[model samples]
Target: MWPLPVRPERSYSGEIRNFSKLFGTERNRFGSLHKLTLYYLPIAIFVAVYVLIILRNLRWFRIPVWTIMMAGAVAMIFSGAIPLGDAYASINLNVIFFLLGMFSVVAGMDLSGLLEYLTLKLLRVAKSPQKAFGLVLIGISMMSAFLVNDTLALMATPIMLSVAKQLRIRPGVFLITLALGVTIGSTMTAIGNPQNLLIALSTGIPNPMLDFLYYLAPPTLAGLGVTYLILRWYYRKEFANSTLAQLQVNPREAIKDRKLAKLSGWAAGIVVLGFFLVGIAELFGIQGNFNLGTISLLGATIVFLGSGRRREILRSVDWGIILFFISLFIVMQAFWESNALQSLMIYLPVLNRSDPGLSLVTIILASAFFSQLLSNVPFVAVYIKAMQAAGFTGADVKAWMALAGASTLAGGISLLGAASNVIVLEEAESRGSGFGFVEFSKIGLLVTIPNLLILYLFLRVL
Candidate 1:
């Protein structure tokens, strides 16, 4: 039989050392797992959402974007990737409220028939196919600078189609023009689209409205002009030997509620005027900490309560979109806390350089290309975080403005590149024939490339 081993003395110090070893092993294991879950899980969820968005056929089943965002957020919470409070705090309420207001006001205007009346009047003046094309460009571009491009696309697509039908021309080019117009024009103002709103709120510029007007507006106008010419040339065959013909639309008949239409118009005017006043007020330090979202929501609430179409308008409001924003915040915040993005940026040190002009161009290019792949709204959300992680400063508003322009304008490069463009395409389909993806990309890229080139030059020079 083997001799029995001698037992060690039962000392407290030895027991303590054993305990420390056990504790350290458990801690290291836990930490490693935590880091993995924090980064990979959210990235997986983010990618899944992006995939669903890219594949248009999946939308036929009516899977709302909110569903995907919620799933990602819930996964993060359950995985312990982020604390509940931090995740909740990640959402920018100001941006959410702003989008809500835009939705309600747009719904109110459309329901009040004010949108139809104005659109018909614009259509009536387009005497020919070429004139109709030019007129559509002008109207849509201007409207998108103030009105969210998606709302204008929904309202204007049918109006433009009516003009095209009257002129005996293909509706495809006209509809595409509207999609491209809104995509380009939305770059003109902070309130122009959700992405712009997100960028403005994130940067906290003292006078975001003025900044947009001064730095970005000129470029936006140039882009629209160039886009107009490109579209005109591309559709030249369609307008060959055509003369300006009077539009068949009757503005009077299109106005269903005379008083309501007038009221909605005034409400829109007041909201726009309020934007400037509030922006200027903040600029002069009267209400330096003022939130433009509040002003916009105030306008929305007034129009909602006064328009007498509460049921219809409220029901039409994009609540899903609001939810999507909230969930996206939670998911992105987890990613931000993960530190993976910061680690990745070590590979691109030049992007984090301190030159405002060069940095702005870099951001614009990154945002524009990824926007075509990921869609501008979500891309902006994630990209802004990435920028912050890269040590980007908001000291210069030019970079943010450049991103706003590049991202919004990049939507014109592909049919699937933007939410507003998708809305226009679907609406056009419901009305009549639509352009296929191949045809759309051909013209879309042709126009968008030159505009981006012009914008890059404008930013570099001025």
Candidate 2:
């Protein structure tokens, strides 16, 4: 038989029209509806049903919270809410690969007993409860800067809980400390947080380790100092009768498998080195870069093939978080293609201004506030296009960069505020030392208020 001609892909409008037929239910709307009844009726029905389901949380037709979010994202993307571009997809791929590599290396470290051994040794050196708190704060912070806050919190929370149980101190307070430390530390590097990556990609900010510190370092120092002081005041009564003498645990005892520890450390080091090498190579505009994710997968493959630890690593990885990013990336791409974000920027009163510094401060404050409401990653992507459309210059770009950084930092102030916050809290809870949102937000407010102001002031000075 003669082959049937392949039809051209239907336009988006055509596809939507076809999908509309599935939900076509007649309704008497105010006795007589307008001429565009078919389109209007179906949309009205969909909206009514959707709102009802949401408000009632109906069991029969309920969707997962994530799926609902993705649906809104689809609307926003086509409606110009997000405004991420094709270029963003490439950047995201790099980010995903980098994260994958990092995760693999971290998995190896966890399985190899390196992280556990290091945790114990660090704790042992900390001896007294006060010192232990300090070390835990510093260690988790440093790890987060390199490994990202989410991973650092996931792996470290249980270990911190174990230490708290042994030392007989309040784990909740320390858990808070660990959580804040990671949030603060994450501001130091682009790889530390998703928003940081967005800022880097959008603003063309290079050497985040250095560029970020121009604004972030000072605030982070203030945050760290403030965090310490806050913890001290809060925990002063707790530490009043205790000492920080190093706990008596032999280093050898902590190393369950020295061979595995060495292998894991080496693998992790290679993954980290890849980032540094890529950063350096960027100076010459070279490609062939392997990101954190790819490096992690490589390390994971090694561990899986050689150490027989693939199953455990796969089970342990945050698959949900990974999928969230994938969906997020697609939606962001849609926003970029649709130019939805640009339209939103046109509507923002702050960007329709003449003063550069004022524009800078406004963007910073706006980003900080919205980040608390919307996820920082999406917020960053949206505003980045807004800032660009507003004709941000070199210095203006710097201001926007600072704004993105501060917005993410603001997330440190609330529990329902950031992904990292939820991850850390959930992990701690899993180990029987969970914290409440009210409690965390109470402490977070103290940190966020002052820290955001400091960030604003620093940006003004620059």
Candidate 3:
């Protein structure tokens, strides 16, 4: 039962031709649409997400930053800007794991009240308000150099507020000092903040911890000194004749859980030791597979196993930040894949491979500016790729260090410039005392300019 042969013009190919003619070339139109979606949609999503994040404080658009980033990532996936598998692969699990471990260890310290106890002990050395202010800046910044700055901001805010109350001054000045201190101090070490950690792990730099300290510590110390002088002069009236000797602060009272405090303190110490050991080994030409992430996770494991209050500590971890990084990776991956930034990259200062001095200046300036817009971590993630594209490599130690320093100091340029600033602000606001954006920026500008100059000069000389 053979069917009747179909006419040549009425074939499937003929139907496609007819459909193309009727609909103005369906394939071409679809192709153009797909290209538009792939090439341009991610950029729109990226800008929209950033806008939402910047305006999130507005009453009408009060959304969590993490939610905005997560939504953008989803949009990218759904819009076909990037594939699902690639999106999944884009997330740097090492970063996520490292953050989780550090957060857990810090959480244990915070929940056990060890951080407050130690903070008060450090600040107790101040006999006068001026001295106390200096102590606060130095102590918090030093702590931030080892502990991640955002976590320190969270732990230090209430303590600083209490110190302010004890000193009989407004909390505003102390909050600003803290915001700047963390931003400056975290520049000195790879594990000092999330962005620094990202740079350390992503750049494939050998002995990152040692390299960071060697390059950044001088600038950080100088920056802290400058910060102290600036704050003292800027708020001289607030601390004039203010004697901390008259106010009694008992550090022992800050300890809530003695056992947990002991355990967490030891755990933190071990982590720091571990970091140094790894760096020293690398310096001596010995190499190991264990990285910062593994060392931190080991410390976290110690806290989890030894502390009875592990659940409470775990709950205190900033999962939103973890989620933010995860989402950010996907969104940035999509943008990178779409080649949206290629045009813009050509306009950036040329990162000369031969003249690192020229590259250093360019990297520092660019990092300082864009960090304000995208925040340090996201900017570093994007900029690292850009640096590589411009012929910089892991062996360009000075350039990478410049990036770490500038991006961190840039956080002190504005309130929204660093995650630590946001943490401090949110913590202060919840306690009914906080500095406004403009108020912070005023002090921030004074602090950031000198710090950036110091960083650049030190990097150049070193």
What lDDT, from 0 to 1, does candidate 3 have? 0.87
Q: Please report how far candidate 1 places residue 148 from its true position, in Å.
A: 0.8
Estimate, for each residue in 186-286, the C-alpha lDDT of model 3 and write its tens digit. 89999999889988988888889899999999989988888899889999998875667556678898889898888889989999999999999998898
Worst 10 residues of 1 by lDDT: 344-353
Say which prediction, candidate 2 or candidate 3, comes out ahead on TM-score.
3
**What is the per-residue lDDT of model 2 for residues 198-288, given as tens digits with 9 covering 90 to 100?**
5665566555445665666776777677777777777787777654442455556656556666766777676667656766776667666
lDDT of 1 at 309: 75
Between candidates 1 and 3, the one scoring higher on lDDT is 3
List candidate 2 segments past 4 Å from native: 1-91, 208-210, 213-215, 241-251, 284-306, 346-349, 352-356, 393-397
Candidate number with greatest lDDT: 3
RMSD, candidate 1, Å:
3.8
* Residue 414 lDDT (model 1): 83
TM-score of 1: 0.91
**lDDT scores of the candidates, listed in order:** 0.78, 0.64, 0.87
Residue pairs of candidate 3 with colliding backbone atoms: none
Which 10-residue span in candidate 2 carries the lowest summed lDDT?
Answer: 34-43
Residue 76, candidate 1: Cα error in Å is: 1.9
Which of candidates 1 and 2 reaches a greater lDDT?
1
**What tens-digit string does per-residue lDDT give for candidate 1 at 204-303?**
6668888888888888888888888888988899888554554567878887777667766777787789889987887778864446678778878787
